[model samples]
Target: MRRTFKWGFIGVMVLIVGLFLDYTLPQHDVVRITDTYNRVTPLGSLNRLFYASPDAGTKPGTAAPDIRFIAAVRPNGKVIVYRNEDTGWIWPPFFKFNSSNLQAEASAMKSTADAPRWVMVTNYGWRIPFLSTYPNAIGIRAVSGPDVKVFPWLNIFILVVLALIVVFFWRMWVRFRERTLDPLIAGGQERWDRTEARAENAAADVKSWWRRIIRRGR
Candidate 1:
């Protein structure tokens, strides 16, 4: 039972970590830019987390924000729409404040089905139609073709550094346990043993005195 519980806990932890990495890590998609446009879309509470905040100059509590979108078709004829917004000083740490410029770039690269201009889009997020959420496009560039390979060297380096950091902290924690925590725990056990011994001795002396008093009376 204990072994099953331990394995279950480890599986849960691994799943959580895998999902976190999948959501945060940058991914590349080679698609043909079909259209680029802006729309005044209202953000609901459920889907608002996927979108970026309004520009820094916008007033707070603004309703029905205008968001830019870039629509593209993958090589396999799958449609993927990306919301181009400025992730200004927020999560994912992209620091992308040039949404307007990116929109212009995407517009220039737009192509039709006959002569599709395959472009590589670097983005991080998931598109959930149920929640009305779209992936946030970080940057876009023209590629040779849809079959062009994209090596995620940045993601590889990031994962390596993260692994090293985890290893370093794990080693540090083990060293701390050996150097500080282990001795303190041993010392506590020794003190507890001494206290128990003293308690037993006092109880034995009291019983012996009571028996002597009873014998003398007899």
Candidate 2:
């Protein structure tokens, strides 16, 4: 039972970490730009975390910011929307500050369905229509065609570094248990044994004294 619980806890932790990395890491989408426009959208508590902050210098008001949007169509004829915004100095650490320039580039790349101009968009975040959250676009560039092979070197490097960090910490934890925690536990067990021995000796003495008094009374 203890082994099962330990394995279950580790599995849960691994799943949470995997999901966090999947959401935070940058991803690529190759699509044809259909349109680019700005909309005054109101952000609520539910979807606010997915969008950029007003302090990012992309939008001004907190209640309802004028958000720039890029609409694109995938090769399979499905549509996907991306929000253009600066990532500011914090969070995700994309350091994106040229949202306007990116909007312009996306606008220029806009093409019709007949003559599509494929582009690779590097972005992070998820688009949940139910919650009205859209993926934030970080960078965009023209590609040869819809099937252009785009290698994710940055993601590969980050994953490797993260794996190394996890391994290093795991080793540190094991060493700490062996060098520090195990010894403390052993010392505690020794102290407990001594305490039990003393308690037993005191009870034995009390019983002997009582017996002697009873004999004197008789």
Candidate 3:
């Protein structure tokens, strides 16, 4: 029984750990974005080129610098705007923007302190495409975060199972260690007391018989 209980506890712990990992791991979803640039170059060369050539002598009316922006979600629920320029793509964390800033923009947007869901983006300086799909986006991937609300039923189920397991083990431990010896000790003590009382009664009866016999002889 002890071995069985130990193994059961170990299995429960393993299951709990597995569930925790399942919620925390990152999942990637890829989509095609229209206003995004998807060019790949040698890793270190792009940074050098951007630093070397900083100035272009073109007028503002000619054309804006060709750059694209895309949204990306980190594994921990942080949203980042990736600015793809002529040099290379840069990741600028977007969660820094507050609700006040989002409300000022003329776009379909929902912003809160920690949660920002932008249906469309209006900033045009970066020339990024507005991916219309909410579930999926182009040049941007939405990843899963460790959100407890996502699986309420599973969470409740696990919690209830764990509580019941704890209660069961506690009862077993009590029965194994405490209840077993109490009954034996109590029974033995009662037997000893009864034997002592019988011996005293027998001694008193023998003394009475001796006195009666002596008195009759007299």
Best by lDDT: 1
lDDT of 3 at 197: 89
RMSD of 3: 20.8
- Which window of 10 residues has the lowest lDDT sum in candidate 1? 54-63
Candidate 2 lDDT by residue in tens digits, 28-136: 9999999999998888888888887653544464468888999999999999999998888878899988898999999999999888899999999888999888889
| Span of ten consecutive residues with least summed lDDT in model 3 | 132-141
Which lDDT tens digits does candidate 3 get at residues 31-125?
Answer: 21222233232224323222111122323333333333354443355564543322112222121223222322312222333663423222212
- Which lDDT values do the candidates have, in the order given? 0.91, 0.90, 0.40
The C-alpha TM-scores of every prediction are 0.86, 0.89, 0.22
Per-model clash counts, in order, read: 0, 0, 2
Arranged by lDDT with the best first, the candidates are 1, 2, 3
- Which has the better TM-score: candidate 1, or candidate 2? 2
Show model 2 residue runs off by greater than 4 Å: 55-60, 204-218
lDDT of 1: 0.91
RMSD to truth, every model: 2.6, 2.2, 20.8
What shift in Å separates residue 66 of candidate 2 from its native position after superposition? 1.2
Q: How high is the lDDT of residue 188 in model 1?
A: 96
Candidate 3, residue 38: lDDT: 32
